[model samples]
Target: MIFKMAWKNIWRNKVRTLIILISIVLGIWAGTFILAYAFGLIEQRVNDAIGYEVSHLQIHQPDYLLDNDPQFVIKKSTDLLNTIKKDERVKAASQRTLVHAMLATASNNAGAKTMGIEPQGENTVTQIASCIVDGEYLEDSDKNKILIGKKLAEKLKLKIRSKIVLTFQDTDKNIVSAAFRVKGVFSTYNAGLEQSTIYALKKDLDRLLNLKQEAHEIAILLQGADLVTDFTQEQKSKFAALSIRTWSEIVPELALMTNSLDQYLVIFLLIILLALSFGIINVMLMAVLERVREIGMLMAIGMSKLRLFFMVVLETCLVFCLAAPLGLLLAFGVITYLQNTGLDLSSAYGESYGALGFRTIIYPQLQAVYYLRIMLMVAVTAILASIYPAYTALRLEPVEAIRKI
Candidate 1:
């Protein structure tokens, strides 16, 4: 009976009810859209980091990461690679010979970290082949073929088939220089990485460094992100001598950003709800004030104070219940459409996003749980917003309220 009365009473003033409903709907819809965008940006950053910067996991000799010395090679790397390949949780694994070398063109020289990778294995573990913007990826048949980033190529004033010399210390502590022709130019979202990394065939680097089949690093991609911890733990037990690190440990800043995203989103939603609550409070109070005489008559006719307060609260809840679902549905449809046709901010803000290693095209995403939480938050805010108006109704003197103009 109270719910039916509250519903009918809220609609008695159609203009006021519509005004409040519109506010609630817009508030929920805007909040949801903003959160979805945030989720998309975070997702993109993590994907790019995993796909290009670091694979899910990496295995390295104890001192190899500390100093890029050619002597600190993983023992029995081929056997370890085979063992890793047989694991069902692993999507791909690649053995790499790493060296810090100076890349020299005829007129310019830049320091870069050279990665010697198996052509096929590297492709499986990283998206280097797909990120090739110009020319072609490395192949087994191509000897001394090198891949450089577009940014680096521009800095060095070099292009495809340009001969560049790499100078580094070999396994025996002797400085050796090898000439490599640029076979591919790749570009990733990360500007810093683009200017300081190079790639070559693992066989060529192993021979140049006199390491035979030994490798300094083994990078692995897991079938899914959820498998990272379990896979890393299992690999740690098997390869205790080698240092195994997940992408989180490799990039702590990215891990921190991902971890704090949920909390930040909660705060963002609360701020929106807080603002909307004030508007609700004003509208509900006006409803109460306008009906003062009617409320007094009901009280005088034996309607209890508690019932009047509860009726007002119920009205507030009904307003939210009516508006929340419509808002959520609209948000869902818009998000779904944007997911397929990404929101392109590139034309307006390409350089800014690129500087932070983010692509300007974003596909907004939110889990089902987020919508549920938003609905709950709206319900709570409605109840809280009704408190002052409900109290004002309870405080009314029936004799005085009935006589007021």
Candidate 2:
């Protein structure tokens, strides 16, 4: 009986009730979609970082990156790389030698982290082969051939077959300058990498440095990302001489964003819900105020205060029940459709986003558990919003309310 009364009471002021319901619905839908968009952006960035920039794990000499010294080459690197590649968990592995060098053209010079690589191994791990926008990929058969990034080519005013010089310090602290012809120009989503990095054949570079079969770094890609932590730990014990770090260690900022994403999104949703709750509370209060005389009549007819409070609380719950499910369903449908179609910011913001190492085409997504969590939050908000109005009804004096209005 009380449920029927509560249901009827909420609809008594249909226009006002609708205003609050619609407000809650829009708030929830907008909030959820925003979360999905943010999630998609981060997820894409992480995948690209792992796939294109850094692999699942990287092995480096203990002090090699501190100053990019070619002298700090990994001991027996070829054996280490060959052995590690045989692991069933390892999808691919590659060795690279690094040098802090200057890339120079006749009219320009810029600082560069020049990488010495084996073409086929590099293609497997970093997929640099696929990023070539001009010319062809590096060829193992060719000596003194180079791959330069697009931005670097633009900065240096370079093109295919352009002759450039790489100057750096060798292991003996002696200055070494070598000339190479640009074989290919590639572009990466990371603009910073484009301007600061270049690649040459290890066979050619190692001869210049007078090192045989030595590498400064070994990049390993795992069959599954989830194996990173365990593989890193296992390798650490196996090769305590080398520094084995996961992607998170190499890119702390990206890892931090991924780890804290959920907490931040939940807080953001709470702020939106809080704003919607205020409007809901005001509408609920108005409903109670206008029904003062009706409430008094019910109390005078021996309706207990507890029942009155419960009835008002039920009205608030019913209002939420009417709106939140529809909003959640609508949001879920939109998210599902967009996850495939994606929101392409390529037209307006592709360059800007790619410069920051992010993909411009974002596919919004949310874990299924988050939807349940949002539903619980809405229910809690509804109950909390009902308290003041239910308490006001309880405080009403039956005789005064009946006589006054």
| TM-score per candidate, chains pooled | 0.95, 0.96
Query: Cα deviation in Å at residue 129, candidate 2?
Result: 1.8
Looking at candidate 1, the ten consecutive residues that score lowest on lDDT are 187-196
**Distance from true position, residue 103, model 2, in Å?**
0.8
In model 1, the Cα lDDT at residue 70 comes to 89
Clashing pairs in 2: none
Worst 10 residues of 2 by lDDT: 188-197
Q: How many backbone clashes does candidate 2 have?
A: 0
lDDT of each: 0.91, 0.91
